[model samples]
Target: MSVYSMKTGLSSILKAYSPTEREKAKNIAINKVRFEMPKLKGILDAVEAVNEHNNFQPLNEFVAYLREAELSDNDFLRLMSDAHKLINDLSPKFTNLVEALISLPWTKRQPPALQAYAEFYIDIMVAHNKYVQFGIPKLISLWIPADGDAALWPNGSPIEALKTELEAVHRLLDRILTAIPMSFEIVLEAIESKFPYFKKATHVIAGYIHSVLWLIEYKPIFTEFVVQLVLQKLVLLDVNAPRSEIEETDYDDEELEENENAEIFEMDDCPKVGNIFAFLISLTTTDDDVQPMKHPIAHTIDICMEKMFNFLNTKNPNLLNASAEQKLQLNKFWKILLSAFDNVILPSHNTHHVQFLLFYYCSFKNTIAEAFLTSLWDKIKNPNISAVIRQAAVGYIASFLARAKFVHLPVLKYYLKELCNWAHQYIQSCDQYRQNGSLKANIVFFSLCQAVFYVIAFRSRDLTVDRKSLLFLQSLQLSAIVTCNFNPLRVCLPPVATAFAGVTRAYQLAYCHAILERNARRKLATVYANDVATPEETLDTFFPFDPYLLKLSEKRITLHYLQYQASEAEEASVVAGHRSPRRQRKRGDSEMLDDVDDFIVADKRQRNIELARSQEREAQFTYGLSPGFHM
Candidate 1:
C-alpha cells in the first residue's frame, strides 16, 4: 500500500467518528438538564414546603437525610450544591435545619465534599446575615479536634485532622468575611469563647493555636486581636507554671526523656506510663499508688510556648526581602505586641516564660530593641506609675540589658547611665530631706539600685572594654549610689550584692567589703539581742529574661541570648590588677586584722555621732516629711 493511500484512509475514518459542533453543544445541554432536573426539584420542594407551612420541618428532614445517607462524595457534593441554591429562600427562621446542618461531621468528609459544605455555609451566612452568629461559631468549633479524633490516620500523626478541617474552615471564613465584612465581629467572639483552656490536652490547645495562626495568615485584619488573645492565654499559662516550682522540683532524667518522646495527642487514652501527661492523668484517677510528677505544668507551658514561638516566627517579616509596606505592618505588629506585654505580662508575677514573646520580637531590629528599652526606662522613671509596676519594669530592663546579646554596648551604657542617674537623684532627694526611712519606705530606690548592680554584674566586660568606656562607667557615680543611706547592698539578694561587690572591688570602682562586713555584724548583733522580730527586707531575684528553659522553644531564645561568662569577671579582675588578698591570707593576718579593726572603729564613731545628733534633734526633726513638703 502507498503512504498517501493509508493517510487518506485514516483521515476519512477520523472524520466519520468525530461529532459535529452542534451535536457536541446539544449533548452538553442534555447532560446539564439531566443533572439539574432532580437538584431543581429538591430545591423547589424545600423552598415551597418552608414557604407554605412557615416552618423548617421539610428543610430539617432534607438535612437529616443528607446526614443519614451514606452517599458517595460526589453525590453528597451535588446535594450540598442544591442546598446552596436555596440560600436566598433560607432565613433566620430555619433554626432546625441550621442546627442539623451544623451537627453534621462535615470535617470528616473528603476534600470536595468539605469544600462544598463550606460553600453552602458561606452562602447561607451571606444570604441571611443573622445566620452568621450561628455559622461562625460552628466553623470555629471545628478548629479544635474532638477527643479520639485528632489523629485521623491510624498511624497517629498529631493535629492531622485539625489541620485539614481548619484549612476548609478558614477558607469558608475568608469567603464569608469578603461577602459580609460585619461578620468578623461574630468571628472574633466565637474564637475567644472557643479557645481551649490551658489545662486541656496539649494537642487540643495546639490545634486552636494552629487555627489562630491560620486566621492571621488568611485574614490580616485579625492580626492585632489574635496576637493579643494568644499572648493573654500564654500569660495565663505562664503564671500558673511558676518558675519557683520548676526550680524546686527535681525532674528525673528518665521522666524528662519520656516527656520528650511522648506524642502530644496520645495523652487522652494512651499516655506513656511515666511521662508528664500520664502523671497529670493520675491526679484524676482513683488509684493512690502513683507518685506526683515534677512540674507537669512546665510541660504544658513548653508545648504552648513552642507553638507560639513558631507562630511568631512565621509572622516575622524578613528584613532582607520585605518591602516598605511590610516593614510598616511589622512595626504595627511590634507595637501591638509591646502593648500586650505591658498590659498582660508585666503585671504578672512569678511567670516563667511568657515574656519571651517580646524578647523574640525585639530581635527583629535594633530599633525595636532600642524602643523597648526606652519604654521600660520610661516606666521606671515615671513617678505616677505604681511602685510595683515600676519595679518590674526596672527588672525587665536590667534583665534585657544583661541577657540580650543583640543589645549593643552603647545602648546598654545609655540605659545603665540613665538608671544610675535616677538612683543618684533619688539618694540626693532622700539626703536633702533627711528622709532616713526604713528599707520598706525606700523600696523603689533600692530596686533601681539592684537593677543597676545586676546589669553591671552581667555586662561588666562589655562595659569595661576601653579607657573611654571606663571613664563613662566612673562618671555614672555608681559608688555614690551604692554608699547611699538606702544601702541597696544590704537589702538586695545576697548573691547579687556579693557579685556586685566582687565586680566593683576587682575594678577598683568601689569598696563594698567593709560596708558588707559591718552589715553582717549588725545582723548578727540583732539576732543575738532577740531583735529578729523585724522582718528582713530583700529584693526578689527576678531576672525575667533568664535562660529560656523550655526544651522546644530554647532554640528561638539561645540564638539571641548572652550567656554568662564566669571567666569574664576573673579576666577583668586580672587585667585591672586587682586580686582578692583574702584568698591568700590567714585568718589572723595583721593587715586583714587591721582592716577589720578600722571598719569597726569607723562604724562605732559614725553611730555614736548619729545617736548624739538624734537625741539633740528629737524635738525638731520628724521621721516623715514635714507639713507642706512634697517628695
Candidate 2:
C-alpha cells in the first residue's frame, strides 16, 4: 500500500478496536512505517511522506516507533549512517526538512531520533558549506529591518518561524561547540571558509555562536572557545570604528524621529558594532550580587580588558571629537566591558588574578606599548593637552603602577621617578606660565600631586625610599608654590589645590610614619635626618612663612587669651556672688537653668517689642496722620 492507504487502513483498524486494544493496534500500525523507513529517502522525507495530509497520524506513529526503537551506541551509529546517506540526497528545501524532522515530539525525547536529527542537521550544513556560509548570515540579517532588507526576507516569512529555524540549527551548532563526536567538523570548516571577522556578517555570526553557547549546558572546554570568538569581534569593532565613515544622510534626524523604536545603531555607526557589546554582555552574564563561580576565559578577558583600558587611557583627539553618536557608542562599549570586568572577571578570581592584569598593562615598553609609561606621563605633563585626557592617562598609569607586582616594582619605581621629575619641571614652568596667566600648568601640577598620593597609598608599606623621598620633596614643592602664590592657586584651581593639600598631608603622614617605623626597625633616632624633609618640617615651612599665616596664628592666640580672661572674670564673679539672681551666668549648663534663662530672654524681648509698638502708634496719632504723613 501507499503511505496514505496505510494510514487509512490503520485508522479503520483503530476505530474497530476498543480503547484497551487501540494502543496495541497503534503499535502494529507504527511498526509498519518503521519497516518501510529503510527504503525511504531519509527519516525526514519519510516523516513528511507519511504525514502529508497534516492529520499527523503517520507522524504520531513515527514517534511511537522511535520511542520503542533501540538507542544503544551501535543503533545510534546505524541511524547516523542512514542520516549520512539521506543528507547526500538533500534538495533546496533541506533547511525546511531538517526543521520538520526536529519538530517531531520524539526527536528530543527518543535519544536515537534526537541523535539522528542532530547529525543530519550538521551533515546538511556541512554538505552545503558555501550555502551555510552565505545563508546563515543572510538569515541573521533578517532579524533587523534596514536598507530595504525587509523585502529580502520571503514575502510570508514569519519571525517565529525564522527563530525556530535558527534554534534548531543552533542546537546542532551547540553539539559541535560541545564536541559531541559529530561526524564532521562544522566549526573548523566555518572558521576556515567563512572567516567571520572583518566581514559584514561578523556580528551575526557572533550572535549565532552566542546562542549556541547560551543554550548548551556549561562545558568547561567550550568556555574559552566561545570567549575567543567574542574577543575577536570586539577587536574587530574597535579597529573598524575609526576607519568607517558615516554617510551624510546616515543620521538624518527626521528619518530617526519617524522610527523611534527601531535600532538606531545603523543610523550613523557601523552596522552591528553595538552587537559586539551585546555578545559580550550576554556571554559574561551572571546573577547580580553573585560571583561567577567560574573564571572567564582568563587570557581573553584580560586582553580585552587591557584593550579597553588603553583605549580609554589615551585622549584620541580624533575620537574625542568624533561624531556624538560614535563617541556615545564607544563610551557605552567601554562602560559595559568595564562593568563586566568588575562583576564577572574580577570576582571569578580565587586569588590575585589582577597580578596578571597588572603584568599585561605594564609589560609594554618604548614604541611597542599601546599606552606606554613615557607617553602617558608626557600626556599628563603636557599643558596644551585636554585636561580630561591628561587626567585619565595619569589616573590609569598611576593606578597600575601603584598595584604593580614585585616583579615589576623596579619599573614602577622608574616611572614614579619620571613623574617626580615632571612635577619638578611643572613647578618651574608654572612660573613662566604664571606670567602668561595660563592655568593649565597649575591643573597638571595639582593632578600630579593626586597621582603621587595614590601611588603612596597603594604602596604605603612597600614604597621604596626613593619613591617616598621624591613624593615628599614634590609635596613640599607644591606647598611652597601654593603658599607663595596663594591667591592664584585658590582663584584659579581651588578644588584641585584643596585636594592637593589633603593629598600632601596624607603623604606627609604616611612618610612620617614610615620614617618612624624605619628608625624603630634600626633602633636609631626617630627623627628623620635625610634630605627629604620630615612631615614636621613640611608643616613648619607652611607656617611662620606666610604673613597671612602669621596674622591668623596671632589672632588665634589672642582669641584664646581673651577667652581665658573672660572665663577668669566669670569665675571671679561667681566666687564673689552669693547666688544672687542679679548675678550673670555662664552661657549654658545643659540643665533647667539654661532653659529658664532662654525663656526669660525671649519674654523680655517680647515686652520691649510691645512697648515700641505702642509708642510708635501714639506718635502717629499725635501727629494727626493716618500712620502715613506728618501733619
Candidate 3:
C-alpha cells in the first residue's frame, strides 16, 4: 500500500527481507496474470515443471523443445515476460530464490541451475506485471549488499557463497538491466558502498548507462528513475579533499566531510537531496522538447562544465596526470569521469588543435555565443594530454552543442565557416579515399551533430534572419554532405556517426523542431507590435537600413518556390552566382568615412537656385527633376 524504503526498517530477524515485500510481490504476480491472462495459466505450469529435468542440454536444444511444446509467439513472449516477474520481486519466495541464486557453488550445474534461473525469472515476470499495474513499492528489494569487509554470517549460515553469486548478480544486473531490478539496485548499492575494486562496478554501470542512453533514450520517465537510483550516492560530492578510507571526491564539503563527484550528482550526499538535482539535470527526459526550454542534457553540460573546471583547477597535476600515466587502470574515481566524457564527446573532434575545432567545439565553451574558441583550442591540443583530459574536451563540446540547439541559440560564425570547410574537405576526399581503399561511406559519421547543424542552419535560420547567413552555411554543409556521400573524393572522415542514432536524421528532427518552434514563438509575440506600431523600429533593429519603400512579403518568396519547382532549377543556379542586392546602411561599412561628401544627397530643387547650382556635384540619383532647375 505504501512505498517500501531502505530507510524504514522493521527491526528484522533471519529473513533478510520483509512481509510487506512478500505481499507486494503477490500483487505484482496477480496483476501480470490479469494483463496477459491467456498465457498466465501456462506460465505457472512451466515454472512448476522447470525442475523436472536432471539432464542438461545445450541452449539451442532447450529452445527447440520449448518451441515443440507450442510456445512460440505469445508463449515465448510470456515466458520472457514471466522471467522478469520472478527476478523483480523481493518477496519471501524471491528472497529464497536470491539465496539459492547466490549460494550455488557454480551455476554451471547444467539443468538445475537452468531450472533455478527459470523459476527465478518466472517470479521476475510476476513482479514486472505488478510494477506495471503498481510500482516499486510492490517491487522486490532483493539485495542486501555487503562491502569488501562485510559483517560475517552465522557459523551454519549460507552466505559465504554470496561472493560468487554477487558477482553473477553484478554481471546479470548489467546484462539484464531492467529485467532484474532488485539485483541491479542491490549490486549498485553495494558497489557504491564497498566493492573490493571499483573497476568491476564502474564497468557494469558504464555499460548499463550507455545501453540505456542508446536503447531506452526515448523512455525518459524510466531513464530518470534509473539514472537517479544509480547516481544517487554521487550527490555527497566533497568539494574539499578526500580524507576517509573511501577515495575523496573532487570537492571539499565542510558539511558532510564527504568527497563528491560534482559532475554526476550535485548534492551534499544527504540521501534525500543528493542525486535529485543532478539526476534531474540528466533526467531521461524529452519534455522540454515540446517547447523551447533548456534540456536536462544542457543542465548536464552546465553541471559538467562547472565540476570539471573545478576538478581541473583544484586537482594536483600529479594526481590528475596519474590517469594519463595509468590509462584506464587501477582508477575508480576517474572511470566515472571517463564514461561520462565518452558518452558526451563527439567522434569528429578528437583533438582541440584542429584549425576549425571551434566550429565543433564552441558549444562546449562557456556559452555558445560567448565561448572563446581560440582559447579553448589552445587548451586541448597538447600532445602530452591524458585520455581523460581528451574526454573532458569532447564532453564539453557535445554538451555545449546539445544545449545551444535545445535553447534556440545560434552557434558562432567562426565555427560555421570552419565546419563548412571541414565538410567540404570530407566530401572532396571521398573519390581519392575510395581509389586508395581507405574510404568509408559515412561522412557525418559522427554527423548526428552535423545533421542538427544543417537543419538549424539550412531549414530554420534561413535567409532573411540576419541576411540568411545560414544559406551560405547550408551551401557548405550540403556540399560536405554530397562530398562525403560520393566515393571519388580523396578525404577522410573520422567515423563516429554509425553507432550513434541521434547524430543523424533522428537528431536533425530535434534541431528542426526546436528552431521552428522558437521562430514561431518569436513571431507570435511580435504580432501586435510589428503590425500596429511604427514599422521603422522593427526594420531598423533587424535590417539596420532605411526601411524599404515597398517591403517584400515572405509569401512572395514562398510562392516562387512553390510555383517553379523543377522548371526553375537551372535558372536558380545561374542567379546563385550573383549576390542579392542589399540596402546600404551607414554604420557598418568602413569606407563610409571616406565618402562623406558623396553621401550628402541634398536635392538641387530643394536648395535655393544659387545653392542648387553650387551643390550640383553632390546631387545623386535625383528623380523627376531637371538638373538645372532649382525651384
Could you give candidate 2's per-residue lDDT for residues 65-98 as a string of tens digits?
5555555555555556655676665555444434
Minimum summed lDDT over a 10-residue window in model 3 is located at 539-548
Model 1 per-residue lDDT tens digits across residues 1-631: 4567587764333333346876997667655543444334554586687799765555654654544545577767876786777778767666666666656777668978887887787777767777777878888887775666545422112445455656767777788888998988998999999998888765577667767877888788898898888878878877776654664563444654454355233433432443455445434553123232246666656766767777777657665788888888887888888888888888888666899888887887788889999999899888899989988898888888987878988898888888888887887887899986576677678878888877776676677677897788789887897787777877765445555665676567887766666666555565457645343455654667765556555666766777553324344233212222322221111221112111112223444344333323321221221110000
Model 2 CA RMSD to the hidden true structure, in angstroms? 26.4
User: What are the runs in model 3 whose C-alpha is more than 4 Å off?
Assistant: 1-340, 343-412, 432-459, 462-464, 468-480, 483-631
lDDT per model vs. reference: 0.66, 0.38, 0.30
What's the ranking of the predictions by TM-score, best on top? 1, 2, 3
lDDT of 3 by residue, 192-280 (tens): 34312222222232222322332223333243333333333222221111122111221124412321122234332363464354346
Leading candidate by TM-score: 1
Using all chains and alpha carbons, the TM-scores for the candidates as numbered come to: 0.73, 0.34, 0.23
How far residue 450's Cα lies from its native spot in candidate 3, in Å, is 5.0
TM-score of 1: 0.73
Better of 1 and 2 by TM-score: 1
As a whole number from 0 to 100, the lDDT of residue 612 in candidate 2 is: 38
Prediction 3 TM-score vs. true: 0.23
- Candidate 1 Cα lDDT to native: 0.66
